[model samples]
Target chain A: MDAKRLTLFAGHYGSGKTNIALNWAYRLRDEGRAVTVADLDIVNPYFRTKDAEDDLARRGIGLIVSEYANSNVDLPALPSQIYSLVDDRSTYGVLDIGGDDRGALALGRWVPSIIAEDDYDMLFVVNKARPLTRTVEDTLEVYAEVEAACGLPFTGIVNNTNLGPETTAQTVLASMEYAESVARATGLPLKMTCVDKRLINDFAGQVDSLFPLDILELYYMQKEGM
Target chain B: MGEKVLMKGNEAMAEAAILAGCRHYFGYPITPQTEVAAYMAKKMPKIGGTFLQAESEIAAINMVYGVASTGKPAMTSSSSPGISLKAEGISYLAGADLPGLIVNVQRGGPGLGGIQPSQSDYFFATRGPGHGDFHVLVFAPASVQEMADLTGKAFHLAWKYRMPAMLLADGTLGQMMEPVELPEPHDAFGTDNPWATTGTNMEREHNIVNSLYLSPEELERKNIERFERYKQVEAEECLWEEYLMDDAEICVVSYGITARISKNAIAEARKEGIKVGMIRPITLWPFPNKALAAAADKVDSFLSVELNMGQMVEDIKLAIDCKKPVDFCGRVGGMIPTPDEVLDHIRALAEGGR
Candidate 1:
């Protein structure tokens, strides 16, 4: 399947959705596609797409963020430039949403425009390692929460399971069963499976599309002096 | 003791609070401190504990007062702005002599400040949390592990002294992730206190929980009694860490997140053959005076490095009775001083003094 003209990534917090969305935006920009990565994350102050705005701008990808991003204010100020990307059909727009239902409420505002104008795909990125979505039933509950909040049906599942630095091929491969269960429960396609670039060769034929993880920045602070 | 698990400072404090037998948590959400409430919300229900997200910070601390009135371990957490709102309730809790834990994951602020980490609240926390002659036993945590450890200790100390205690952390400590070995859940200390306002059904004399004393002499006596307890806390509960102070010529004093940076600066300065050390105060209220005073007798000079504009330096000077030249190096308004910046201060202190 080709990349949808408009794509939104939504999932639970700490589900590795932001990294997946960032990797996808860079892929489109590198391929000479007109891309705009909108940071619709207002829930978490840390690990938002807005942190990488300068890097995205240099690569010719438009980055939209909250007016209060990187400042300490909790109040969100979404820019009017966001609607321009949604109205433009030529641009491959990727909305990196905040975690869970509270974050999905932000996406609800642009629902009418999203449905009326563009052929969009809202992919629910799943990571089994996160706390709330460890079990099959728990995964279904998270999907339902996001769906109910966003008022948009998820189009597919993008399995992006890992335990940060401890992740190996086994870590990525072992999540296949859990990801398949989520796809079956939601009646959605398992569109892609993400693995770090180092292990792409091992998982070529196993998944539908192997998304190589080109992680540019890791902002998670480790223990001091470790 | 359990296996060390990688966790955020906010979540670690939540776990440690639960492990400390604190079953009641009432808090309003604020930036750089919301995760503590989120973690409590997720875990408190499953464990059959009360996790009420109050309508406002004022209501949250009042809820804390209610739970603490029952002689049960209760807690409320917030950042800078929210803590300001909870000031009235905190004073009420202190005046009533209610034992509870108040976690302040401090952000930069005088009013609606930025969400980045800051130690600017040193004056607000230690000097006077609210009106009247009162002090919340403030413990400043520098690491995720201390975030967990001090939470448990704060609860125990709050109960031990029958006074309000605070775990004063900054945004960096609250948001940062590190491995922590969580303490075992202590048994609940509920309704066992002799002076608790549990209804007396002809069991004994009625116990009242309040701060009201109509007579002038009675109020003075109550104030004197509280000070006596404070004196004991100062004697027994002053906790600090002196890193490389044995042969140090320049003593760097800091606490909380700033202390972490100072420790690194001390190491860097030592690498260059500069005799630098640090005194990281785990407890901010007692001020760790004796240790700094002793160090003053030997060290050539002192440098107070903090996230605020030299608030704690005044205390450092008073602690040593102005014997040594205590210089100040710090950043304000959410800016963190780099190790190099602090190291430069250490070098300057070394060169300017004997």
Candidate 2:
């Protein structure tokens, strides 16, 4: 897979953008590249990239997030450090934009610099499992809303459909047609299909551009063997 | 049961409410629970339902009151501070013997507290939501599945008892994602409600839905009648889940997100040879006094784990009739106690430490 200098993920709420962005950053880091991941999510009050700050730091990856990221204050304050994502061309930058048009509005401010560089891939991550985006038409509506809000055309589509921890190999396989339909409608390349790392063995020679992810253990406090 | 789907707790509850025949949703957005309002705003209109983003929390709840009076299942959701603003309307719903669903996805609070998960609103919900001698039914869900399942149950029980009900959740449960088998959709509005203020086709007397009583004697009578129904609720509807309670000596009590954390602690404690178990209260208002009372006779001591500063400890003591030594372990103001912290507390209790 060809890696871009700037990889941005944006989609509907709870569409697995944060997980994808984090995994993408880790992949870049593993390739011996200088990677920095930014949390551009201002709409959501929880479950942002900052939640994995220590993990990112341990991997020797840079993180640029809001000052009020994990605070009680739910202000739409973007940190000034985001400027470095564009200014520092030497480092690879991956961004997890917030959900929907309101969340994508934050990307509008950085559009000029990003467009001028022309070295980025803005991927529209779609999840067929989310009730609102189950259909091809619905997914495109969200795609158009996000693109218009951020003032950037999506360069590719990523199929990230899954049922949380219950996601199976069949779930990813079944979502292929939906993902292809979305890509065909938008006239964008189907860059990748995200599969749970546990289910990667099931997709052996059948799938292309498969990005395997270790599912984010969000509910680690939950009792085991339940 | 339908195929399982992944959803955040907030979104699960909103979708569950819709499936349970709720056609009207009135709410103002607040953190940890705004997804409820957002989900409703997008889907309600497409499904021929009413979704109104009222001017304020107070207005939103009053709007729920208006819809519920028509014998239709109506709902409103908010976080800690917003729920406080809706207190008056909640009390009115109880006083008028009207059934409605109120969801409080709690964040830390006294005044505009942080947007982190906390069980600080336990007293606010279990006691009375508004100014009156009444109790609203409260269901605390620990997982995304329960968030959806209890939503349907809350609506059923609220209408069955003709009282307001609350799905009390914390920030962690509201924000976290998990797989859930959603309930099948049903039309709750079509049910026959003899007490509803629906227009009588001149064939029967007009039903008047109200809470105001002019005479003190009449007001006292109404209050007593409401208590009678609450008594029936206590007898028949108390819900709780017991984990590894058999042959246990040290019992742990918790609800909502804290219960999930406590379960992890209990599992570790068991591995280390501690006989600790957990009794998770699904129904907070009913309180599951009988289960605790039964366990109190066997357990040497009790630990009340909470996300607030000992709000539920008082109820734990009352439930067990103060029979055993009840210890309080908690975190307040948006901080959650880790499993290690709870395990450490359990370790201390097993070692005879306070």
Q: Model 2 Cα displacement at A57 (Å)?
A: 2.6
C-alpha TM-score for every candidate: 0.89, 0.97
Off by over 4 Å in 2: A218-226, B188-190
Kindly list the per-residue Cα lDDT of model 2 for residues B290-354, writing each as its tens digit. 99999999988999999988988899889888999999899998888888899998998899932
Residue-level lDDT for B143 in candidate 2: 93
All-Cα superposition RMSD per candidate: 3.3, 1.8
lDDT of 2 by residue, A144-194 (tens): 999999998899999999997688889889999999999999999999999
Q: What is the TM-score of chain B alone in each candidate?
A: 0.98, 0.98
Top-lDDT candidate index = 2
lDDT, model 2? 0.91
Q: What is the lDDT of residue A148 in candidate 2?
A: 92
Q: Docking quality tier of candidate 2?
A: medium
What are the lDDT scores of the predictions, listed in order?
0.84, 0.91
Instruction: Return the TM-scores of chain A for each candidate in numbered order.
Output: 0.93, 0.96
| iRMS, all models | 3.5, 2.2
